[model samples]
Target chain A: AQRVTQPEKLLSVFKGAPVELKCNYSYSGSPELFWYVQYSRQRLQLLLRHISRESIKGFTADLNKGETSFHLKKPFAQEEDSAMYYCALSLMDSSYKLIFGSGTRLLVRP
Target chain B: EAGVTQFPSHSVIEKGQTVTLRCDPISGHDNLYWYRRVMGKEIKFLLHFVKESKQDESGMPNNRFLAERTGGTYSTLKVQPAELEDSGVYFCASSLSKAGGSYYNEQFFGPGTRLTVL
Candidate 1:
């Protein structure tokens, strides 16, 4: 079965502190992973994709096929970075359907 | 450029009642998808529409849920004899048509409709 797992329900960090939100997946085929963020009063939006290999909003995630992880990392966290993060897996069949994890709430304290 | 929109941001109804949720995708987007998030659970896919056609609906929970996209435009999801387990946040997303054979596009999501069952 294909599934995405986010171990932490809430991850707290102080401003300027390092932040890491863990995500793991179980799939037999090549997986396409994505990180989505939803801020207060905002719609869920794509933060980054493993395919892009780019950083957005000072956050980056690298896909490790051996470990089956796509953990999101940021060297310095900001107050605005506090939001609900979800790791999702896209089906390889090109259906464009996303399978999401339980999600992790990152709260950056001042 | 408007984003995807869902009607009735919140709805409270008793069990066994019927509710219809509407979703209007961004103008010109051909791929529309429906997802639901139960409390403390992952956001799960419900269905997918490609221009008035049900491209994939394997994610739909059961026969009680029916989704339709008339004229390849806006879509509607109707739940008959709703149950308590149906209560959750329903999200609608839209993306552009696939280019070549790769499906690499951002799916614009709506504000989502929160359904509550009494």
Candidate 2:
């Protein structure tokens, strides 16, 4: 079984400040990690994936096996970045069934 | 191309009433998935369909929930005698199949249907 943990329910940051959303996971096998974002009144969309090693909308995440974490980070936060973010983990044993975290609501105040 | 689309964006009904939600996946996508989120809970997988067949349904809550993708184009999830705990948002996602492959493709999601059972 796989489980995702997002400790923070709410995170606030000022515009132009750096931001980070922490995520941790417990899985016995190799894991595929992803970050999903949902804007107000919008559908959930994939932001980034550990397998791709890419960044989207100035946001990037690095998967650390030693730390059992995948933290999303942005050098400078923008008001548009405020949204609900979920961290998910998937194992091949489960046929790519995603186990999502409870989600963290990010607020960027200008 | 258009993204995945779901019908009956919102529905409200009595406890014993049956509700059916629809999902239209992107054209040419062979993999479809269903998920739901209850209040204060994480979004959990309900099932997965590959074309017209159910590939995986280990996450389905119970027999009260039935899903079908008859023609492999669109799918529907019917919840019979819904309980108060069934009130939540149901999301549908579609992705291209990568069968027998190690990597998985990204899934496109619909806006989701919000069901309220009183």
Candidate 3:
């Protein structure tokens, strides 16, 4: 079975401070990880993926296979960055079903 | 192009009532997926469809839920005799078929339909 764990339910930080959202997974095969975000009143949208190695909105995440983790990070968080972040794992099976972690809500205060 | 769309943005019904939710994926997408997020829980996958065929349904919670994609263009999820625990937001997503590469396409999600069972 594939499982994702997000230990934090709510994280708060002052504006311009660094932010890190932790995520860990348990999968039998090589994991495909992704981060999805939902801003207030907006639909859930993809933020980034491990394989893409790309940063969006100044956020970057490195997949640490040894740690079985994919933690999202940003050098400096913005108020707009506040959102519900979910870590997801795509199973190795043919269908590539996504298993999502319980989300962490980030609140950026001015 | 239009993004994925789901009908009946919100529905409220009593327990044991039957409700049908609809999803319209982006045109030309071949892979469609269904997911739900119950109150205070993570978004959970319910099923997937490759074209018109059901590819995976391992996440469906019980027999009271039925999902179908007739022409591969759109899909529907029916919950008959819904329970109080069935209240949640149902989301639909779609992606282009896998291109020849190590990376698969990103899925675009709909706004989701919020269902409330009293």
Interface RMSD of each: 1.0, 1.3, 1.1
Q: Residue A8's C-alpha lDDT in candidate 3?
A: 100
- Tell me how large the interface RMSD of candidate 1 is: 1.0
Model 3 error, position A107 (Å): 0.4
Task: Indicate which candidate wins on TM-score.
Answer: 1
Model 3 segments beyond 4 Å from truth?
B100-102
Q: In model 1, state the lDDT of residue B30.
A: 95
Badly placed stretches (over 4 Å) of model 2 are none
Kindly list the per-residue Cα lDDT of model 1 for residues A11-100, writing each as its tens digit: 999999999999999999889999999999999999999999999999999999999999999999999999999999998675679999
Better of 1 and 3 by TM-score: 1
Q: Write the per-residue lDDT of candidate 3 for residues A1-110, one digit (tens) a residue.
A: 78999999999999999999999999988899999999998988999999999999999999999999999999899999999999999886768778999999999999
Q: Across residues B1-118, which tens digit of lDDT does each residue of candidate 3 receive?
A: 7799999999999999999999999999999999999999999999999999999998899999999999899999999999999999999999988766456688899999999999
* lDDT string, candidate 2, B23-97, tens digits: 999999998999999999999999999899998999899999999999998999999989999999999999998
Instruction: Extract clashing residue pairs from model 2.
Output: none
What DockQ, on C-alphas, does every prediction get?
0.82, 0.79, 0.81
